[model samples]
Target: MKSFRLFLIASLIFITNNFLFSQEEDVVEDSTETLEVYLIDNYLQGENEKILVLSWMTNLPTKSKVKIEEIGTFNVSDTLTDFHQTKIDLSNVRFTKNEYMFKIISELEDGSSVESEEYSFLVPFEEKDTSSTKSTTTSQQVKTSSSYYIYNFALGITLWLLPSPALAFENNKTKFAILKDLPLVSIGSFSAYKTFPYVYFYAGYVHIPEGFVKNSFRLGTKYLYELPEIKHFVSLGLGGFTNFKGSNGINGEIGFSFLKVLKTFEMTASYSYNYLPSSKNKFHLFSIGLFTSSFSINLNY
Candidate 1:
């Protein structure tokens, strides 16, 4: 009995020691500082003296600075933020080397710091033949412009090919609706512009199952302010409507739409206020359907 008790006590002690060690390891891992930074985009900008534009985002809210080897460190943000975009002037720095290595250092209020992996950028070399360079650049710009229009054309053909359904309300009357969008044209460059002017044709039908089962048809033109990052749009529309039971009249509408990006097509939820001048009628409309435009509109300008 004494020997058995000794073995049991030793086994319990061994299990307890392992459990305590595991707990300590967990604590250490949890307390470790972690921060990650990602590069969004970069470019060179200037009319006379060029500047390097570096934009990056962090996983955590931190006051961050970027350190370039040979060149001095540049401050990015004074307050803690997850997004950081800054322009670093390279006018004074001598480009003795072709490339330079840089890293992002992020520090929290508690003085805990973390660093990103080293990144490098190459300096752009100047062209010798100015006349040839200008001609080449002009040709490239023309090709880019053509590609932009072609892309939007293909997108219009594929995405807005089908008309979807919606729910509409007018004068406290609810009706089932069929909606279609014919995108006329879109104007903006993907890289340089944040907002795009979109012109499209809008058509819809409201079906009412009363008396003779009246059908109301509306045809309109819509002008929209498209915001790509926020995935939303604001629109103004003017059209004429004809009812099988009532008289024809002119109507105006203001609409707001939210866009959801999907693999094949973008889904849209829209709300609008509509007014008719002839009948003195006012209505609110809500629609949920696929949009003719993508949330990420590819452009070059």
Candidate 2:
């Protein structure tokens, strides 16, 4: 009986030690070898210049954060419930003109983390000489091209004739317009060979009598399409304007435009229909404007 008890006690001790060691292994952390991280470039949205966000993927689910070398810390990533792919916001970081280096650090609930290698990027047109007008112009052009490639522009005027008592077309409404596109026309000597989807802008006037129309000036965006192998183009737009008495004139304007870019300029025409309850009026405009090398139009953003 004594010998049997000794054997049992030894067996219990061995089992206990093995169990404790196995638990320690489970609690132990894994290295960042499974983490893959990189940076995305910034783009200008409206008047704001957006910062580059960090994107990463992991083989395991983990919490992530990004730290810039000198700028500051960013928000903790959305709880990475899944490890497939994620984008972390860099907007909170205050960035200045210069080169910057940043990294991604991923953590776990057990207080362990894996950090990424340093990544670097440049913020454009920052900290440059303010005296050189040429340098300033170049920088501004670069900024504009990065945001808008203005390849085509058009200016047109319209005459709207309303029949009156004596004159055949007595009340004449004279209006003017300009249409433009972000140019993806040519990259050096090579002409773009694809149908282009683009955005255009419109600014115009509708000359109705002061009592008939208030705030005839109009500005809006249009989606433009220019077909490859042909200079013809089409577009649609949704816009808002002041009414004859100065409220909301064109609440939802469905505009249709077709224009042909020529050797020197372009010829264009468009129709706008606004269907409001109990209202039966439409807008027709004809313009000679500039043309583009591609095709596109998107009225809703």
The Cα local distance difference test for each model comes to: 0.66, 0.46
lDDT of each residue in 1-301, candidate 2, tens digit only: 9999999999999999999998787766443245554444423222134445344455555677767777666655556432323343445555565567777687755557878788765544344476764433112322445223233331211111111111011125434433232223221111122233466554544443332332355556666665544655566676655544534456333333255334433444445543223333334334333433333222321
Lowest-sum lDDT 10-residue window in model 1: 134-143
Relative to the unseen true structure, what is the C-alpha lDDT of residue 286 in candidate 1, on a scale of 0 to 100?
71
Judged by lDDT, which candidate is best? Answer: 1
Candidate 1 local lDDT, 1-301, one digit each (tens): 9999999999999999999999999999998757777788665565336587898877677898889999989999898777788899988776655567888888887778778898887665343466664421111111257888789768766666655666667666777666555444444443322344466565666554431224567777777777667767777778776775565656666666665544444566666555555667666557665655343343333
TM-score of candidate 1 on Cα atoms, chains taken together? 0.47
Candidate 1: where are CA atoms >4 Å away? Answer: 1-11, 30-33, 125-167, 170-267, 270-284, 288-301
How well does candidate 1 score on lDDT at residue 26? 98
Worst lDDT 10-window in candidate 2:
159-168
RMSD of 1: 10.9
- TM-score for candidate 2, residues paired by index: 0.32
